[model samples]
Target chain A: MVKPIIEVFDLTAAYGDFVLLDKVTFDVRRGEVFVILGGSGCGKSTLMKHLIGLLRPAAGRILIDGGDINNASGQERADLLKKFGVMYQSGALFGSLTLEENVMLPMEEFTKLPPEARRLVARMKLSLVGLERFSGHFPSEVSGGMQKRAAIARAMALDPEVLFLDEPSAGLDPVTSAGLDELILRLNKNLGVTFVIVSHELASIYAVADRVIMLDQTKKGILAEGAPGELRDHDSNPFVHAFFHRETAEVAG
Target chain B: MDFNQKTGCLKLGARLDAGEVSALWSAVGGRVRHVDASPLETCDGAGLALIWYVQKGGATVTGLRPEIAALLRPFDHLPVDPADAPPRDNSLFGQLGRAASQIWNDTRDQVAFIGEFTVTALRCAVSPGQVRWGDMWVIAQRAGVDALIVAGMVSLLTGMIMAFQSSVPLKQFGVDIFVVNLVALAILRELGPIMTAVVLAGRSGSAFAAEIGTMKVNEEIDALVTMGIEPMRFLVVPRVLAGFLVTPVLTVYANFLGVAGGFFVMMALGFPFMALWNQLVSAVGVTDVMTGTIKSFVFGILVAGVGCLRGLQTGTGASAVGVSTTRAVVSGIFLIVLVDAVFAAIFYTIQW
Candidate 1:
């Protein structure tokens, strides 16, 4: 069996008094597109945060590659984080900097590349995301689609092995969202980078997801996990069936 | 053949899986030039990774059992790279240079902002209708009337303290009547304006910074920018005009309350009301009142300018708002004192 790239061992996420995810265990295999699907407020974003090491889990462990991420010190966790790229939902671009400078930020911090080389790499990453012309513009000056593309370019600046995206299709129109989906497929095929995405949009999920884990807010745990088509067709749970097929009766009740 | 000598060969234990690594490493001294796995029983990916790290520097392994080698074959070609270098420039000189450059940028931005504010104010002064009278009235009530009690109380206490401090020495020489002259001259000339400036800086100046800083963080400033309305004209001008129109009045009001406080002390010291009033009227001249009022008017400009500048310069985040507020109060107080000193020197030279 191929070794998984990321391992979540009985992880529980909590905020002081409220438990978000309870004893969740999962594994993301190498080179696979893994989607985390859930209704709103079901701890999807919280799980993403815990996976990216932005927030520590309340219990259990998160192992990235082969290193124990939760047990690692600051420097060790930073080294582990270099293996993964993350694009936040808001795009999280520095409002004061140009897109080119924003892409160069990670390279400047993490690599010893010279100024010209850093600029060249930044331009290349921007071009990869179809943002070559908008490199000189600030984040606020660009369209929302352009901003998200620039943010993705910034995340890919270091050529990480794993890419984690939090709701890449959120707030984007259907046409723009389809374009982003195509870009993600192209990148995944060309670069062979593993992806762990948290999303709710059914079309984007079915189009891109190799497998998905459905989280339930009321259940406070995963309701189903499998290939999206299989889960939609074969899963006996009414909630999973309703969520994937877009039926409103069982879910709304 | 014993494994201790003749090229640092490590003899593998019976169980070389993940659970036995610590004890095995302690026994093996952490550096193995060669591995002899003849006695090996079991191994996993973790055990293979451990051996790879131990033998990372071009070590040779002999006598590895075929099963153990098979277990390690999957990870045999793991990439070897050098440790990454840490980030740079944490030394004191680097920090000092960064701070100096930041201060230089701040000063330049402040100068440019002052120019912009001056142009806006002058334009509004020429076309009075450009100013929003409603906002000006609202800000005047906030920055002036609401601030009256705190300003009045501080100035009054300051006057009483000044009078009481002067009375002991004057009464010794049978000159208790002169306390009113000293209090009136000093309060009207310097203390009233300077003290009122400090109070305004603490009260309205910091409030201005906080209000605008919150707006900046909430993106309301950006919304205004997109709406094509000049924020300086719409937001800042009212505050500045309110400061200019209200500070002098506050200073004058503070001056009288201060004089009355001195009267309270003087009357307690057995000086008659008419005599104290007569001394005060004779001692405080038109020039003294004008000097204090004019100084206070300039102080108002300083407070409003610094407050607005710091607020507009705010960066993003929760801490950025706090930092802007602190910078506003600090720079407001600093510029007030510095301007007062420059005025004192100019007046001394002119014998005002």
Candidate 2:
């Protein structure tokens, strides 16, 4: 079996007095699409934040290839950040820069490539996301879906080993969301990049995820974790069953 | 399996793309000197560039298919073109047009905000219960009263320096006592209010812009709008009222410190304390104190108004907060000086 790229050992995440995720554990394997699934308020986003080192876990540790991310120094964290990329829910594109410039920002910061090479790579990344035409457009000038695509392009600028996306399809229409799902699958398969996405959309989960971990709000831990088909077919947890089947609250926990 | 040591050949992978090029090429290194293109599945410019780099390190390329060799030819060396041109707006006329439009928009927004604020101010005046007394007290303590010590120190030093400088020339004429009157009139009539406004512009004015700009960025302002709360009344009124009430009091405090500073300097110049006090009293009338108080009140409105206006006009993103904070300080100071000049002219014409 391939070694896991990311390991979470009894990770506990909290904001002050409120604990969102408690003692959750999981592993995301290299070159596989790992999806975090949960109902609203289940701390799926909080767990994602912890994995990306945005929030230091209140307890336990997160290891990225045997290095403890929670306890790493500032420079170590920055080095770790270059190993993975993040696409926030709102796209979080720098509003002041055009889409091409935004994609070039990471390259300029991290790579020794000359300006022309950086621009070419930026254009290539934009093309990968099907946003090459919108390279010169400001984030505000584009549609929401284009912004999300541009953000993903920026995230991939450094050719990160892992990509973390937080609800990439939240504000997109179904067609656009499906397009993004297809793009994710293409990148994952063609480029052999690992994806760890936090999403509750069953369609997206079924389309791109090789494996999924379902977090339960009441339990504040993993309710189920396995291949999507296996979990949907046989997982006995009511939340998991209800979620996969899109059942009404009558059978939901 | 791809790299055969005996044959000195490393076969490329199916997806020889940009991201994989560096890692795969490094793995092959210059040790395996021959690259076998027989099993090469795909490649791009970046992949070919890496192969060319390895070939330059004394590695040889052999068993290459014709099509793949043609694909690799263009990237054999770095392109000799100039760097990508940096994006910019270079047209002077276009910049001027944009600046004019921005100024027009800003003025219109400011006028509309002032109208909304004045309506809220009228409501607060008529029915004070609509104003949140608790928020007012907190803001007053944070933005006004807490600033007293620094304001006092600065005003004191300013008055002492003014007295020392003026007394040097007066002492040559043996008229050092007149320094007391000069300091008193200056502090009570102009310097006190102006200095107080300058300090507040840097302190509470920027603070107001930053705090509200952050809220605007975080969509708290949108949340307030959705909740059917008037942000102008809910947020701006208490702050404006706090500024209006506290500024004049702070100016009064500053005026007293300035007089004390002047008295200290007079004593060092060998003038009696009572003589300096008598001169100050004879020189400064009720009109001087009133003018400073009224000017401070106006300056207070300008500071709070411009600060909140800049915040409310904040655009999106992290840099927007910083831009609003800077605009608040610049415009707040400019408006204060302009209003003071207008006040000076009116007072001069009326002989107040």
Candidate 3:
């Protein structure tokens, strides 16, 4: 079996006394579309924060690529963060930056490439997300879907080995959402990049996720982790059953 | 449900673009709401936010008066020009027109800034009554403590310098008796408040701008506005009040320290101790110290007002922070100098 590129053990966290995630453990394989499935506020986003070193676990460790990022030095942590691209829920694109510049930000900060080379790299990444046409377009000038794709392009700009996207299709239409799901699958299949996606969009999960991690909100997070098909057929937990049940999506074939 | 299947968004983009914010509340007796340009379409969120921020910040300043907002209608339709200019357009009339339009654009920008400042100030000054007294006390305490500490250190060094400088002069004059008087009067009335105000403008004024500017950037100001509150009542008035209240106390402390600075210089100048003490005591009356303290108070008010105003005018991101801070310090010093001149006029005019 391949070694897990990411690991979390006995993880729990809180904001003051309010518990966010509790005792969550999981491992993600390299270059797979790993889904963290949960409703809003189900601690999935919190887990993402913990994974990225934005928040520290209360009682456990997160080992990313064999190193405990929580315990890493500031520079080391930044270096680790530089290795993964994040598409925040709102995309968090700098307003002052055009779509191309947004894609080039990480490269500019982390790479030694001169100006023209950086633009070339940024343009190439934008095209990978089908956004080459929108390179000079500002975030406000693009559609929601385009912004997310631009964010994805920005995320992939550094050619990161791991991609962490927080709800890539939260506000998109179903068709657009499906398009994004396919994009995720294609990126994983083609680019050999590990993807950790946080979303409760069942269609998206079933369509793209190879392995699903479910957060049981009432029973303290990541309640089940397995193939989505298995979880649908075998899981006895009420929430799990109801979650994957999603009417079996009517094959229609 | 499958809206995309029918028309793929149906050109709602233009509707959303043309949507004014006032259109959002069209239920009762309102006109169309003008929604800001959508975030997904363009991240003009910061620009729209700036409009609100300047309004809240009370941008009631000298430059770019609000009337400039109407002077530049053509600015929104900015024309794009490529590499080479048409060679013959350099007529005097053309130059004058360009200059006039440039000033017009600048004024519009200033008007926008005014709106930004006012919005931020309004956000800061909410609930003025709740902590009004508390804010005053805090400002007073801060000024008094900072003044005393600064004065103590400065006085010790100042006294040493005065002792050294005056020593040579006294030795040269053989009248060394006047050294102590010179030190007391100069330090207490003229040097102390001026020096202290400058220091506070750098230290306290910059800090105020940073703190408020950060709050502005973080959407705290927006939160206040959403809650139907005025920020100026909560943030600005308290700060401005604190400055006015604290400055006088600080001035007194600074004056005392400056005098001690001069005194220390005197002691080292080989002047007779009793003579030095008498000369210093004779030079300083209650009036000189009071006038210095009053000037300090006015300076403090200027510092706080300018700092808070500058802070509230900051844009909703990190980039605007440096600009806010710089403006705060520059404006604070400017106002302090202007007010000082006004005070100088008043003092001399009434010098009966």
TM-score of 1: 0.59
* lDDT per residue (tens digit) for residues A1-253 in model 2: 8779999999888899988888988899999999998889999888988888878899998988777877888888787887888999999999899898999998778655555556666766777788766778888779989999999989988778899999999988999999999999988876778999999888889999999998987888999999999999998877678989999768676
lDDT of 3 at A176: 93
Q: For candidate 1, give the docking quality class from DockQ.
A: incorrect
Top candidate (TM-score): 2
- Candidate that scores best on lDDT: 2
What's model 2's overall lDDT?
A: 0.84
Deviation of model 2 at A175, angstroms: 2.4
For model 2, the superposed segments whose C-alpha errors exceed 4 Å read A9-25, A55-62, A65-80, A217-220, A247-250, B1-89, B123-129
DockQ rank order: 2, 1, 3
Give TM per candidate. 0.59, 0.83, 0.68
Q: Against the hidden true structure, what lDDT does model 1 obtain?
A: 0.83
Q: DockQ of all candidates, in order?
A: 0.07, 0.25, 0.04
Q: List lDDT for all candidates, in order.
A: 0.83, 0.84, 0.69
By lDDT, the candidates rank as: 2, 1, 3
Score residue B313 of candidate 3 by CA lDDT. 73
* iRMS of each prediction: 14.9, 6.9, 20.6
Q: What share of the true interface contacts does each candidate keep?
A: 0.00, 0.05, 0.00
